[model samples]
Target: MAYCGNIRQEGCGKLERREKYRLFLYVLLIGSITALFICWMILIWEKIPGAIHIRAGIRQDLDLNVPVSGKLYKAPAETEDGAIPVTGMNAAVDAREAKTLSVDLAEPLTLYAEDIETYTMDLKLFGLIPFKTVNVQVINDKTLIPAGIPIGIYVKTEGILVIATGDFTGDDGQAKEPVGHLLKEGDYILKVNGREVEGKAAFMRQIEESNGEELVLTILREDQEFDLKVRPERNQDGEYKLGIWIRDNAQGVGTLTYLDENNSFGALGHGINDMDTATLMNLKNGSLYTTEIVSITKGENGTPGELTGVIDYKESNKMGTIEANTVEGIFGELNESAASHITTQAMPIGLKQEVDLGPAQILCSVGGAPQLYDVKITSVHLDHDNINRGIELQITDKTLLETTGGIVQGMSGSPIIQDGKLIGAVTHVLVQDPTRGFGIFIENMLIQ
Candidate 1:
């Protein structure tokens, strides 16, 4: 009986050891979970201000404590090696509750945050492992510009453009399409039957002279080149026809936005679209000539009005050479000073964030000259970062309303200034109201 008691006591000791082991594991697991949660919260704190811009001579505070609460330190934005100085500001940082970092701008400068690292102490390093960049754009605000100047733009597409095609009587005496889906609205016809075609007349002459044979077409679509075959059909007049409408050039009048420090100009807040097919007119080479306002078409409900203007034909009136026709507008280098015509009033750029809903001014010319008229910013929608309609505005100037009725067609690119800053430009007028219009951020134009 004594031997049995000894064995039972030994078994009890083994069971106690197993219970202690499991208890220790549970405590360790809880500690690990807590540490992981803390680390996660700090990681979120590092994602403050994806981008920031400050004008020269201004102090801006960046709050870095919106996410997890932790001790902060001076960390490199791009790498972990050396410190990149923030231009135009005090760079010394205090290692404590790093909630706010102040930046003072003296000149235009950009700094990345790679070498900056957050540490709990001098010995332990922390912050984002890969680090993130802080784009501290220190730009000057005041830019002098001439407003309300008229511009005549002419754009020639990269190649002969196919606008429309229809069916024609064929050799078999049946109505059939010679050019079908192989040609589209925006496609540029580069070559026909191994010969380069220059314009609509050239393309048609080449096709009709094909002797009713198959014509091989070299096509260019959105910078991509391919080849397709199109058959020529003889019409009832005994003449061969490809039955495709084409255009290679477009011209229109618009308002000039602003002249940059480098004498480059941006105009037409939106791109020029083919009025018939409604496709954006692609630019191969283009020019912007000076223009004079001719007449005004009053806008009413359901119909939008426009400013009718004429392009100056005199060679001395040539304003600039256009290089790009983008979604925002057409950009080009100025041939002369724009301030020579209108007021040389220079203003700073009002960022999209700085635009407020209130009374503003739009510089436009309807008949006589470029003038500043009162308008009110009605609403702002930031659903997209790149679209033109960032703000909705309504005309309030009595004289402007009496003269042009509202924003006119050629008023596009009229500069919108609020509180001495060039905020945006007129883009489109509301068809229903005729007195309200859309404005795009000036930063979009500057980017192009």
Candidate 2:
């Protein structure tokens, strides 16, 4: 009986030891998972920025405000032997001692002036581990007159653009597709029969004079030039047709964003796209003219409004010449006649980082004269994929809401001001909520 009791006691002791070993393994696994999760959170909280833009002549501090402790070291090429003073928290003994840190911008930014455009820097985690390389852009700040008055824009394309292709009836009363698969939308008709076609009128004249003869066409598609042979089809009305729709120029009305010290102005927060093809118009030569708003179509849910204006194309009404029609906006120098109208004082521009979510104002000309209206910036994306949508805002001013039904077509280039600084310009209005709209950063427009 004693021996049996000893065996039972020994088996129970063994079982207890085995249970404790299993518990130890479980605890070890749980501890590892928790450690990994904590590390991931730390990394995310200290997410490094891709780039930072600083004004050349400002005494500001670089406030990344990241959670993890780090030291910002300027790149070697940017400094003398890369021995610039370190700006950050002291090295932490452990992860538990980590804390947020910032760099003193006065030293680095002051070194940049008219000569240096940009440089790079390295951020070290815990003052040890390499975190990321950040691009530092140095820009000169400018005071601009935020002009919200309407202007007439006229832009001619580099070549006759083929907006679409269609089938036409020949003189024999049979359907003909002379441009079948030979030309597509967005194609530029550069020349006809080895002669350069200057404008839409000249191109159409060539087509009409083709007399149903096979014409050798030089086309420019996606930067590649090629030749195609197409015969004109005579319609039932005896007019020769190329079975394609083409456009050479576009005209519209938009609000002016600002006028720089050089009298150069930017307008149309977005590019001028073709009505049918929806492609950016390849600008050849264009002009900006004076216009007067004739009517306003108030915006509604899912339906965008517009501002109709009377554009006098006379030389006396020419405001400026359009030098560029870019995706960012249109840029050109305002003539003396137009620049003389800027009676308002210039305001400093606000960088993307300086923009905050709060009360803001927009300068617009809905009532014939430019005026300031209240607004609210709901969101600001510091590093957004779409540069034009970095700032999202809503119309809060009752006066603007009643006048334009919250943001209409011609209000796109209206300047958004916050804290007495020009921060951005209205770019697009939400189709579902006309009261809300997106804006492009003023820094983006200045770069362009």
Candidate 3:
């Protein structure tokens, strides 16, 4: 009986030992998973921006919202003088530990150079672990005269633009699609039967003279040129036509943004898209004319209004010659005589990084004369894909909101000033909310 009792006791002890061992294995597995999860979170938290830019003679504070303490050190850069640290930007300390890194770039109180200079710095977490390496760019500031006066823009397309292809009633009293798949909207007809087309009038004459003959049409679509064969159809009125609508030129009225010391100017804040195709017009040549505001149309929800202006297309009313039409705006040289008549004061331009989210002013000519109106910058998106929409603003001036019912169509390119500096220009107004709009940074226009 004693031996049996001993055997039972041994079995019970072995079972107890096995259970404890299983519990130990479970605890070990749980601890390993928790440690890995914490490490992953730390890595995600450390993904901070790697570079920053600042203009010379301006003070800015940069904050890196890392939870732990970190220190900044001057990183060596390879320049013409070899690996060295640039002292142009002054900071409080070369190395210091802090919970949330904030860099106060207040040194070099004056303009440093006429060109852009780059510097580098290194950030370390807890003065030990690697953080981020930052590249600091300091550029020379520029000054420009913000010109908000109204102007008329006219541009001749590179070639005869095809607006649309349609079927026409033929002389046989039947519908005829002469164009077929030969051409489409937004395509530019460069040549007809080996002859370069100059204007719509010349193109119409060529088609009429074809007399139902198959003609070779050279088409330009999206930077590619191709040839197509099509025969003109005779309408019931005995008129020969290609069954296509075409345009050769476009015109509109818009505000001028700025004038540089050299009389160079940028206007319209955005490109002129075709009304039918909505594509950027290919510019062959264009001109700017002086405009007289005749009347105003108040904007309402879901419908944008415009400024009615009378532009005399005469040599005496020529303001400038437009050289390029781009997504940023139109660039050209102001007529010397017209430049002398501008009475606006030149102000220093503010870089995109310097723009703040607060009160600002926009110079626009609602009446016959240009005037400054109050606005508020609601948002600023740095590194935006659409450069023209870097800043979003809301009209706050009661007089402006009452006069035009917010930003109108012709108000584009109105200069947006903040802190007495030229920051940006109005580019687009929200159709759903005319009181709000988007702007392009002045630096973008200047770079173009």
TM-score for each of the candidates: 0.72, 0.79, 0.75
Residues 48-115 of candidate 1 have per-residue lDDT tens digits of 33334445545434433222221222443433333333433333344453433333222232333432
Candidate 1: which stretches are off by over 4 Å? 1-57, 61-146, 193-196, 312-314, 337-339, 383-386
Ten contiguous residues minimizing lDDT sum, candidate 2: 104-113
Candidate 3: tens digits of C-alpha lDDT, residues 1-448: 9999999999999999999999999999999999996796465333333344556665544443343333333234423432222333333333343211233222231212223555555555544555556555666668899999999989999989999999989999999999887788999998988888989999999999887899999999999999999999899999999899999999999999999999999998888889999998998899999998889899999998789889999999999999999999999999998898789999998867678999999998977779999999998765566778889999999999888989999999999999989999999999999999999988878666
**TM-score leader:** 2
Task: Give the whole-model CA lDDT for all candidates, comma-separated.
Answer: 0.72, 0.81, 0.80
Query: What are the runs in model 2 whose C-alpha is more than 4 Å off?
Result: 1-50, 62-115, 121-134
Worst 10 residues of 1 by lDDT: 116-125
By TM-score rank, best first, the candidates go 2, 3, 1
Q: Looking at candidate 3, what is the lDDT of residue 145? A: 98
Q: After aligning candidate 3 to the native by TM-score, how far in Å is the CA of 236 from where it should be?
A: 2.1
lDDT of predicted model 1: 0.72
Cα deviation in Å at residue 199, candidate 2?
Answer: 1.0
Every candidate's CA RMSD: 11.6, 8.0, 9.1
